[model samples]
Target: MIDYLDLALQYGGFTSLDKVYLARKLAGLTDQQKLDFITPPPSVINAYFAEIYQKQGAEEATDYYLTLSQQLSLFPKEPSFAEEKPFVRLNLSGKAFGFAYVDGTGLAQVFAEQDVEVAENLLFEIAQIFPHYVVFEQAGKVWMKGNDFDETILMAEETEFLLTDVSVSDQFVKISGLNQEEVLQAAEKYDGQRYVAWSGRSAILYIKH
Candidate 1:
C-alpha cells in the first residue's frame, strides 16, 4: 500500500545520491541496525501524521502511522515480511554486492538471501524500492516495461502489471546500460536462479520463481 519511492522523493526530498547511500548502508546492516539510520525524526513523523490525517482526511492516526512507519525508507522497518512481499528473492549462494550506481541512476543492493532492493531505473533511479521491494511487486518491471521510469511508474499506477511467474528461461527481464559481460556476470551471481539471454544496451535478469 505504501510507495517507498514516493515517500523518499515527496517527503524526504531524497536525492539520487541519498537513495544510493541509504541502500549501500542498508545492505550491510541487520534489520535492527537498519532502523538506526532510517528512522525519521519527529518532523518527518509529524509530516506523515498530518498527511494521513489532516491533509488526507483519514479518521485515525496511530495505527495508520504505525503501518506507514514500518514501510517508509526514512523510518526503520519494525514489521516483518508478513505483509510486505519481495519482488524477487535473492539468488541462491549470491554474494552481497557493494555500492553500485549508474549515471543518473539509483543503487542496486544485490545481497545474498536478502532481496536486491531495486534493480535500477525505478521511479527515481530505484524509485520502485518501496518499504523494501514490495513496490516492484505492486508495480511493473523497470527495464522490460519502458525506457523511462516516470512512464513506467505512471503505467503501474494506471494498471496492474500482468506478467505471470514462469521459468527463468522463459522470462526476459531487461536492465538498460549493462553490456553483455556485465549482464552475464549479474546472472551468474544469482547462481542458477537467474539467466541472461541476450544484451545490447539492456540485459536480462530472468529470475526463477
Candidate 2:
C-alpha cells in the first residue's frame, strides 16, 4: 500500500498538510506502511498513479480541461444535448458504419477508439468532407466514416457557409462560400438538368441529368 495521500500532497499540487491527510486517507496503512511507500522508488509511485490514480482522477482532469476550453470559446454556447452524452453511433442501412458515443457535455468523443493512428487518419479525411464527423478506434476497428446527411449539411453550412457573391459573367449568379450543404443543395436543383459555372475551388457546380 502506497502513501497515496502523502504522494498527492507532495507531488500532486496539493497543500502540505492536505498532502499528509490525503496520503493518510488513501494509504490507510499505518505510519510504518506509509514510511515504506514514501521512500519507494519513483517507478513505484509512477505506476500507482498511472494505474490507480489516473482512473480515479479522470473526472477532475476532464472537468478542468473542459472548463478551460469553455472559457476560450469565441461563441460559447452549450450544446443542445449538453446534459446528455455528446456522441451517437452512426448506423446506416442496418449495418453499423461505426460506433459513436458522446461525452458528458455532449462533446463528441474525438479519440475514444483504440487504434488511434488509423482513426486519426480517417478522421482527417472525413473532416475535410464533413467537419462534424468524428472517428475513433475500438478493438482494432475504426467507427464512423463521417457524419450523416443532416449533420454534414448543417456543419458544412455552419462552417464553410453558403452565399451568393457577385458573378463576373453577367448571366450567371456565382455561389461563393459554398460548403458541402450548398453543394448538395445546388446539386439537388439540377437533378434533371445541366448547369455550369467557371470559377471556384473545385468545379463550379455543373449539374446534369
Candidate 3:
C-alpha cells in the first residue's frame, strides 16, 4: 500500500486534518482511481509558466503543485458535526446525495450503480455486504436503502413540516433549531442557492427569497 499520508505531506498542500481525510478517501479507491488523481507536470497544467523546470521530482515541480493547490484553495476543510450522518459519499454521474431520517427509518444500505442488479438481486446482495449503508435508484429517484426500514412513518399525519419535502427551492435553506429570520439571513449570503444543514431534530426552512 502506498503511504497516502506521506504522499500528501510530500505534496505539501494540505493541512494536517485535510491530509488525514484525503488519505482516508484515497485508501478506498480502486487502483485506477488512484492513477487518475496524479497531478500532471506543471508544463502540462499551464504552459504559460512552462519552463524546463517542470520535470517531476524537481524542486520546481513541488513549487508548481503547491502553487496549484493554493490557486485551487482546496484546503482547510473542516467536517461538520451533525445529527444525521451520511450513509456514504456517492461518486455518481454528476449527482451528489445525502439524506436525513424522516422518522421510523431503520437499517443502512449502499449502492453505487444500477446497471446490472435488479431490486430483488440488490436486496439479496445487500445482506452479503452486511452492516454497510446501501443506496439505490427507485422510480427514478435516489434513496438510501435498508431492509429494516419501516416506511409507515412516512405517512404519519403528524408530519411537522420537513425541509426536504415540504419545501425545497433555490434560495431556500435550513439551519436546524433556528428561526425563519436566521435561516433567511444565512441564505441571503448565498445571493441564493438551495441548501440545508441539519443539527437537532427541528429546523426552519425558507422557501422564498
lDDT of all predictions: 0.34, 0.34, 0.35
Across 41-137, the per-residue lDDT of candidate 3 in tens digits comes to 3324444223423344223532443344443232222211221222223233343322222223332223343333334334323322222233344
- In model 3, which runs have C-alpha deviations exceeding 4 angstroms? 38-209
The backbone clash count of each candidate, in order, is 1, 11, 6
Candidate with maximal lDDT: 3
Candidate 2 has an lDDT of: 0.34
- Please write out the lDDT profile of model 1 over residues 66-183, one tens digit for every residue: 3444454322122122312121221222432211111122322222233445432232222222222211222322221212222122211111223321122232333222343444
Most accurate candidate by TM-score:
1
Clash pairs of candidate 1?
124-127
Which stretches of candidate 1 lie above 4 Å from their native place? 1-17, 60-64, 72-209
Better of 2 and 3 by lDDT: 3
